[model samples]
Target: MRHIKEYDGLRGLMALWVLVGHWAATIYIQFPWPANLGNAYAVDVFVILSGFAIATLVERKRETYGIYITRRVLRIFPVYWFYLAISIALAWVSVDMWTNAAGGEATSNRLQISIAALDNFWPNVISHVVALHGAVPRNMVPNGEYAFLGQAWSISLEWQFYLIAPLVIALGVRAASSFKAGLVLVLGLFVLSYISPRFPYSFIGRYSAFFAIGIATYFLVNVGIPFLTQRRIVIAPIAMLIVTALILLQLPSVLPVSIWIVATASVLVPSQFGLSAIAGLLRWKPVQALGQMSYSVYLSHMAVLVLAMLVLEKAGITSTYLHAALLLIITLAGTLIISIASYNFIEVPFQRLGRNLATRPQAAE
Candidate 1:
């Protein structure tokens, strides 16, 4: 139950990967592979990390269920709602441009943003408020997964997992004592994953295997084989990424599995493994700093990218490469600044508040 600095570093890497993937699309650069595939892979890594983190917290803190859930809600919501407000405002201000873009023949990020903002606005807001927007069936709310804050679908999914994690971990604890039992649990989760597409993309079950992998990782590293502490497992994730990248075009379905494997391996491996490249890179101070504010980076980067694109377009800096370069510079700078402020003001304060409230004594319960 020791704190894992490498997990933070890994989170930082995945967040930046997601940002870069989005940046590629924004700048209209087409890779040989599917453009948004990297983003999806990174998000899957996040799902796995969430599972691992939740397991770690449950095992280490042993807080009451109510207290744990309360802390999680506050951890996720305050900063999320802060950015939600920003996204709504930005959408409102740029509605006309979005509308105009929509009328054009070409599809662009602006048009997509406009559609997400304009369609069933109040309904979307209500669903998002309760963090149930991701569960709404697509037929009920077309493209609801990407509505409003496009990246937030995953946040809702994580919220769902937070609600259920204690129960799952309790079951997992029993299973951890028996290899066959643990295998059954994992198999059950994979079955859920197989059926999850019948529901919304943001449904927790859709990513069940990823979460299961993370949970299994926790059991491996913490409970089952702490003696394997000397094993150099960092190469596993790096190799997974490279192999998956090469084969993804032919085997797109391998993405979820591959990403989960990478993420889970990253957790099982220690960052202080005799100067391995990936492990050492993860332990670097700047990477750790980025990891610290990774949630802010993940949520705020898209908005920064959009705003930078708008400003550059207005300035008529439309040469393709120059525009892309400027957008990258401006967006990265803006995102870091906003994310730092948001982390300090919104995230840190709310997190402290959650801690205080959770630790406060109950009266006559």
Candidate 2:
């Protein structure tokens, strides 16, 4: 039940990776480092961590499904709704500018996301309100998942997982054997994957494997395999090296996924001698602070970037390098201020409120 401070730092780092990647891509800047441009991979890491963190919560805390869901709603929705309001406002004001931004191909994708955010405005609002935007396919509703807040597609995905996590945890607990449970879980995920083509690409089924890795890790580190503890320090670097090699080779899909599982599991290993070094870096103060407000940073950065780009374009910043430099500085400054304020005002208070509401006793009949 103890909070893992290192996870916060990891989340912070992932948020920055996504922010910087998007910023760079929008400006057509390619970093020399492969992972530096890996926005999608960073998102996968978020899903893995979400699974790990949520599993830890459900396994340790005894609560009715109603209370559990209530807490989750308050945790996610308050900050999300705040950002949704901002997205809506900006969509009305600057959708046209983004739609017509220069750097033609370089800015097209960002423009598409911004334009779609308001394309079928009402329907997008409704889908986002229910947090089922991720389950709605593009054919049925074009870009519905990313319609309101582009990055919020994953927020809806995480919400869907929160709804089912208790049942998943219960099933895992009842199975009583980690191996048997894992076998069944893998089979179920395979079935889900088989049928996934019939569903939305953004549906939880497509990403459930990452979550399974996290849940499996929870048991491995906490309950199932204590013997692996000392060896994890050695395993961590080996896993990283394999991930790097796989990246270099661009091997089969499953190989990378397998190595990612090892890498993620190693990062979650408890702090000890060699492992503590990794933990120490992850727990650095600035990174930890960034982690504290990471949700706000991730959700709000796009709006900041888009709006800043609009301003710069209108101001006739013609030089590509100059434009990118100015945009980066403005976006970072704006995102940091907004993230800090929102984390303190919106996330913390609503979380406290959710806890109070969830803990209140039901009246007797």
Q: Model 1 Cα displacement at 122 (Å)?
A: 1.2
lDDT of 1 by residue, 213-268 (tens): 67767877775555544563345545456656757666654665564554445545
* Cα displacement (Å) at residue 84, model 1: 0.5
List residue ranges in candidate 2 displaced over 4 A: 28-36, 104-106, 176-187, 227-277, 362-365
Worst 10 residues of 2 by lDDT: 264-273
Predicted candidate 2 versus true structure: per-residue lDDT over 1-365, tens digit per residue = 35777778878988998898878777745556652375767788788888888888888778788888999999999899999888878876656765666653336655676677666888889989878888886677777787758888899889889999887877777677677776776677788788767655568998887887778778766864456655554545555676677678885444425534544543565342256565776788999999999999999998998889888977989888888899889999999999999999999999998878766764321
Where model 1 places Cα greater than 4 Å from the true spot, the runs are: 93-95, 98-113, 176-195, 227-275, 362-365
Candidate 1 CA-lDDT value: 0.75
